[model samples]
Target: MTITHRFLQIAAVAMLLGGCTSKPIYNAQENFSSNMGISENQMQRAIVTALHDRQWKIQSVKPGQIEAEITVRGRHHAEVDIPYSPTSFEIRYRSSWGLDYKNGEIHGNYNRWVNRLRDNVLKELSIDPNIEALNNLGAVKRDVESPSYFAFQEGVERATQAGLLDGSIQFYLSGQPVPGSAHHIRTVTSSRKTNGANKSDKDACIWALQSALVALQSAAKKAGANAVIDIASIDQRSLYKDANNYQCNAGTFMASVALRGELVTLK
Candidate 1:
């Protein structure tokens, strides 16, 4: 073969390889299955709770099916369809935004969220134990309050007081202003975590944001400020961590989100 032809052939092969590597492999459909031996009514309740806990709004519901929507900071949004029976259920992806997608693949985040939902559903289903012995034990404890229980309660109060001293704060997203005019305070940030075993990614995101808000509010209060203002750029710090940022990570049975934002006062 001519040298020119040989070079052209090599270039074509390289181009083909590049195209293949540029696209990631993803599943066209993602689903989760659970068999908790719960009644249909109970299962539906659990499903709703799982979605609500993650900030998902239930758009519609009927026998053996649920439709929900998830919107992240008015940016990324997703629709999820869940169908279940008396003893089993499945969470399936319907659509999404701000995520990688192709004919058959979706961004990994979608799968993570679904998995978290499944875990939460199972947790809710297990809340009502069917074991007679466990039920009896719980009943006895409820009937007979112990002295140590009061002491434990006191300890909880002390812990709460300590948390307040840690300088926690509340924050508002952009456009969600405090009641009246407020001054602009320094930007503040905070974060929280969930093990993904008992909590979903949505729950982790909420907790992280809540923690950050608490810290921000605490700082503002110390500054004699009543509320924060112009809160913007709410997000998850999937790659980098900083003082004013939000991010989430997931593993087999672990998930966490870090949140950060500017602290401003409403004047």
Candidate 2:
């Protein structure tokens, strides 16, 4: 494990200990100097897009503000209000259920969800296109359970159902033979995230893996390749090659999968 991941794991353990007594309530009122020149309508659209992408249901909408809520795995729920102008927006925590809220403190996952909302808003506004980097900036805290791993096929069905992968584009993992005469097109990496609130680690990992597969599939299609071969986990720059399984890191709020593979066309 990288130092950063190790540090996050240690910090999560500390947070768990603190949670035995009281955690902290999270509220965000962010000012965006960078988006000053944008219009109020644009700000609203950005916020709405971010909210939708994160699966937050819009409760109410008006001229300068909106109320939204999310229920995770039919268990945890959170509500927040976004009051925005052309200059900035705020994600103020409203209420929650099934998250151990008491004496002004709530579950750590609440903060992560809100923070991710904030970052996604920034992403919708910013010109930078590195989503993984933005996600990294937002989800700094780790879950009590920091990491999880799973088999390659464990996520394949879900990925196929989600239209992220298909038999048209085959995925050959490391040490798995590439059938037919295949010409390598390029090597690419995909990193993807899935919300982990109240979800099983395996399920979250699979969702994330599905997204990563989609990214690779997109790249392969773009390069006119029919397959992605020699896939391996390259999280934090360390390679974990396997013919069957891949690696995923699951925390309280998010699960992430990063994969590298060579795009190839079988002739």
Candidate 3:
């Protein structure tokens, strides 16, 4: 049978089995998103629609109908930036008295995300280039690749194992008070140690991983290596490579995640 047919067959089987365990299913999906068959537009649209369906009362694009409170919340640590990653905006609703009442305290959440699933939607219009690309990509799958943080972090880890380097590598010139590399990264996941981190930590973690990668790449270039190779997946880094179990203060609200990778001789 053709690959597509085989896919349908496998899907049918999975449906018959009530779908595989969440763990395996997610594992298989991770392979797919990290490698193939994922759409950023679809992700963003689905998120927006899901939120509209759950609330917002009227859901169409009436333009002037919705009131968007666009305000400058001041210059915050321009939170680490990444490319082509998915983010979330979750609004928790609870009746002031209980779930049945409309007078409850309702609040909205805003988070940065990438290459992974998050539990909220981002209503902020002031998004970076990567985020804008994600929102505008639409329902069709677009062939694109920007940069990977996980890859860089893995390079650092590999370097450590090889006795070539030491110390935490910050991808952003973030740690150093100087303008580090102008490079950008996309974090795909993060650890639960981040107090408010829910299942959505993956997006932040991927950003962190990308940060390390860019930093390491710069370091590697300085070390005379042409490139870094064989970067580990975010899940792998979180499970096996990270030493602190993500307990330290990585940054304000950013999870304390340590990743590793290696530099290779140029081909």
Candidate 4:
């Protein structure tokens, strides 16, 4: 081949490889403003709820700041730090693992997550008055008349009495038994609902899990067990109607969820 032709061919190959390998500049910080006429507290709650909907574990929450961790498929993980005020918020990429790039460029999935999270937060911030009223009324009625309501309170009391309601319970989403343990106890469920306004499905889900855990603790105390396992959300049903179920639903103004799990004693 001629020298000129060979040089051109090598340059073309290099260009193609560079184009293929080039990474998009990572947007480390995503800024958002609330023009939906919601208060700062409401906005923060919505953000937290959005994170919860995405299964992000909240590490810490301050007046205007939140730190959360996202785990994808039990392998890939990332940390997001959100700082907010009455009018603005920022979703900042803190750190990541199992992603291809380090700082300048981030994996596409990370961007996608932050974007999706922003969308969800915005949705939660949007307000609807009629729906809010209905949700509030429903919540009030449930508190006054729902058998599950009383059961939940009773469970909380029992758990408190037994000193098992502390956030020390080991929770497993998968229905897997703890290693080196082999004793079965009864399954327990709990459910909770959130007032539609200023709350998101994520917030409701977190509350539902807390209620469910209290119920689980109550059941464990009754069964004389030490731990609960395979904690998970379940569909709302008549069987779970009296027990708070951990199935989260979000509407114009309110959010709700039901949770279920098995109480067990670890060996």
Best by TM-score: 2
lDDT of 4: 0.60
**Model 2 Cα lDDT, one tens digit per residue, 109-169:** 8888988888788666542224345345546125344446688976877788776677688
* Cand. 2 Cα-lDDT: 0.78
Alpha-carbon TM-score of each model against the true structure: 0.37, 0.48, 0.22, 0.38
Question: What C-alpha lDDT does candidate 3 achieve relative to the native structure?
Answer: 0.32
- Rank ordering of all candidates by TM-score, starting from the highest: 2, 4, 1, 3
Per-model tally of clashing residue pairs: 18, 0, 32, 12
In model 2, the worst 10-residue window by lDDT is 126-135
For residue 40, give model 4's deviation from the true position in Å: 1.7
For candidate 1, write residues 191-262 as lDDT tens digits: 333344566444534443444455655667777766555443222111132223333433334333333344
Assess the local accuracy of residue 167 in candidate 2 as a C-alpha lDDT between 0 and 100: 64
For lDDT, the strongest prediction is 2
Q: For residues 1-267, write the lDDT of model 4, one tens digit per residue.
A: 999999999999986765554355334333333322347787689888998998889999999899998989987888888888766677887888876554467567778887778767755644222323444666422443322222343444455566657744545443343665747776565555556566544454445445556666666778877776655543322122222322345554455555556677777
List runs of model 4 lying over 4 Å from the truth.
1-36, 127-267
Residue 133's lDDT in candidate 2: 55
Error of 4 at 258 (Å): 31
Q: Which ranges of candidate 2 are over 4 A from the true structure?
A: 1-146
